[model samples]
Target chain A: MSAFKKIIPLFDRVLIQRVKAAERTASGIYIPEKAQETLNEGLVVAVGPGAFVDGKLQPVALKNGERVLLPPYGGSAVKVGSEEYLLFRDSEILAKLE
Target chain B: MSAFKKIIPLFDRVLIQRVKAAERTASGIYIPEKAQETLNEGLVVAVGPGAFVDGKLQPVALKNGERVLLPPYGGSAVKVGSEEYLLFRDSEILAKLE
Candidate 1:
């Protein structure tokens, strides 16, 4: 987590870390690595200041630590040490997960 | 053009009619339809009120009758009688051509 502290996304960009695939089922059965389903869920690690609109700064709608639904494609990938993070524009995020 | 008057795009959407491919060159040589290059230029037909930002309506940056650069893909296609038009969010338009 310390490595990720250095990154600060710019201008309505959100940095998200994808949730890892479940390794075991709810019933406690182990799942093979090859069969793990890729999840579209992510945790917001950092957020940028809102973009300027009509000369006014509009703040980003998301906050740090919020879970969000991610689009299947389009984001800048970054590797912090061994962990991967993605940066996306606020509009690119599909929804906020409750 | 009367067919298009019925359309009023909503929320920062811009209606654009693509510029037609040239059938003849400037040097007076006739170009076959198959050889004509598809141009990404378009004329703005209409524009929606800008999308709301920070609880305020931010009006679209484009105006009707302006020439604009279109993205290679991603716009809602609409056919008005025999004429085809595209509807795109203001942000999707690449640029405004002077």
Candidate 2:
């Protein structure tokens, strides 16, 4: 691992790391290894200042250290600290872990 | 290449397939096979009816036959027709392809 690509998500954005999808759930069930898809779990590393609402700044509902579900189809992947991370807007987050 | 899971996103949900990342784009630039990262680029397969707003359903601004950029972390991956696809809400979509 060399220099990590500096990532700075703008307004209301989020940085998530994809959780690896290991082997199947037994019974020979296989989870396909697709390029465009990622796992369901992720750790929130960085978050944007907040989202704009009705022309005003609205604080984000998601916070750091929160395990969240990211939208598989809307973020950008970047290498960071020898690992890969995804950048997305606040709306891309589907659910937050309670 | 068999039976695809019947996917009907309830409201504002979307189904996307992960594009496979092959051989580090040559040049030995290994994209790392750590098991979590996926490639960009996917076909919009299915979308949810619509997302629930405040207390009611709002119309979706996205349309079918559109290629979209998916969030890297929020959606759910499922098997559909021998292929893997991800499911996420409409909000997960960031920029639409013009």
Candidate 3:
């Protein structure tokens, strides 16, 4: 988490760290790592200032530490040390989890 | 041209009519219709008011009658009588052709 502080997304771009899939099934059976489905859930790490609108800056709607839904595709993938992160335009975020 | 007056693009969308490909080469050799390449040029027929930014409506950058370069794909297809037109967001226009 501390390593992410160095990355400040620019222009409405949001940096997100994907949440790992569950390792167990609802029936309490252990699921193999290869069988786990990729989750679309993510935690927002940082957001850009905003995209320009008619030459004016409009602030991004997302905030740090917010849990959000991510699209299945798009977004630039980044690897920090051994952990991975993704960068996407604020508009690409599907929705806020809560 | 008169038929186009009835259709107006909305929300920064621009209606464009594609220009036909050339039937002859510079050397005056006749080119078969099947051999001609699809042109990416288009004439803007109408432009939407603008997309909302921070709740404010921003005017579109393009104007009617402007010739522009278009992307190889995207844009909605529309048929009016015997003519075909395409609708694209203002941002999708590649560049203005003087």
Per-residue lDDT over A27-90 for candidate 1, one digit per residue giving the tens place of the 0 to 100 score: 9899999999777667899999888877888777678998765666899998888889999987
Error of 2 at B70 (Å): 23
lDDT tens digits, residue span B1-98, model 1: 11123565655777899999899999989999999999999999878766676669889889999999999998766554478778788999999999
lDDT minimum window of 10 residues, candidate 3 chain A: A1-10
Candidates sorted on lDDT, descending: 3, 1, 2
Native contact share for candidate 2: 0.06
lDDT of 2 at B23: 48
Model 2 chain B scores worst on lDDT over the 10 consecutive residues at: B1-10
Error of 2 at A5 (Å): 9.8
Clash pairs, candidate 3, are none
lDDT of 2 by residue, A1-98 (tens): 46655566688788887767655544866766663344566778888887666666755556788776555477888876668888877666755443
| lDDT agreement with native, every candidate | 0.80, 0.64, 0.80
Best by DockQ: 2
Model 3, position B64: C-alpha lDDT score = 89
Candidate 2 chain B superposition, TM-score = 0.67
| Local lDDT at A41 for model 1 | 68
The DockQ score of candidate 3 comes to 0.03
lDDT of 3 by residue, A20-92 (tens): 9999999999999999999999999878777677769789999999999999998877554477778788899
